[model samples]
Target: MLIDRYNSQLLMVDVQERLAPAIADIAGVEAQIAILLRTAREMAVPVIISEQYRKGLGGTLPSLAGLMPGVQPIEKMEFSCFANADLQAALSGNPGNATILCGIEAHVCVLQTALEMRAAGRLVFVVADAVGSRRPESRSVALDRMRMAGIDVVTTEMVLFEWLRSAAAPEFKPVSQLIR
Candidate 1:
């Protein structure tokens, strides 16, 4: 199924400072996430960001934080973001039924969150290239598990074009510039 922009929301998991450098190909993940964020903004998709134990991991990366000025990251101790009331409220408040996910330590937080969200009846899509773990094996396993649980594992570009849905879309030129 295609990702309809009007029914979708972006959920950025814990891409925190101290954890990011450890994730495999950190730069690649960040780059994909940047494109996702920029596209979300241009399309007016509501974004919900979460930070896991900000006191320890620190906040979301500075570059990502800058892209989302005035939007505070939901701080949570729960590994599964769905366990946190605030995050749940954010998801509940939004009109979106589809959630596009991006973040770190894919085996843990990202994995648990994806499974839970899918179980909760939300159509969840994990941006494969925009998610990572401290170890390549962990990431690989998480992606496989998420897919097994029926989550749509997707790439940033796939999502961008799916949301765009057409070359003639008003934001096409700007979104095209993003990938190039």
Candidate 2:
């Protein structure tokens, strides 16, 4: 199913400083996440970010935090954001829409979150190119697992275009320039 910008929300899960460096292809993941963040802002899709044990992992990376000024992440110790009251509360306001996930450790936090979100009956879409793990195999396995669990595994470009729907969209020219 195509993502509906009006009903969908973006969840940036545990893209922290210390943890981020350990992720394989960290640069690639960050670049895609930047695109997702920009697209979400342009499309008016609400965003909720989560940090797993910030004290240990450090806060969200400076590059990402810089893009999200004035926005604070919901800090959680749980592997799945839904397990935290604050995180769940953050999502409560934007219920019934697809949840687009992009973050680190694809085999852990991102994987667990996607499964729980799917089990809750939320249409979940995990941006494949925007998530990574310390090992490539772990990421690959997790993506396959997410797909088998009924989550839509997509890419950043797919998401941007899907949100826009058509090139005639007013933001089309600027949004398309993001890929260049």
Identify the leading candidate in terms of lDDT. 1
lDDT of 2 by residue, 1-180 (tens): 898888889999999999988888999999999988888887888899999998899999989888878679999999998888998888767678889999988998999989988898888999999999999999999999999999999999999999999999988998899899
Per-residue lDDT over 1-180 for candidate 1, one digit per residue giving the tens place of the 0 to 100 score:
999999999999999999898889999999999899999999998899999999999989999989989678999999999999999889877644799999987999999999998998889999999999989999999999999999999999999999999999999999999999
- Candidate 2 stretches with Cα past 4 Å from truth are none
Question: On a 0 to 100 scale, what is the lDDT of residue 134 in model 2?
Answer: 98
TM-score of each model, in listed order: 0.98, 0.97
Model 1 — which ten-residue stretch has the worst lDDT? 88-97
Clashes of each: 0, 0
| CA lDDT of each prediction against the hidden true structure | 0.93, 0.91
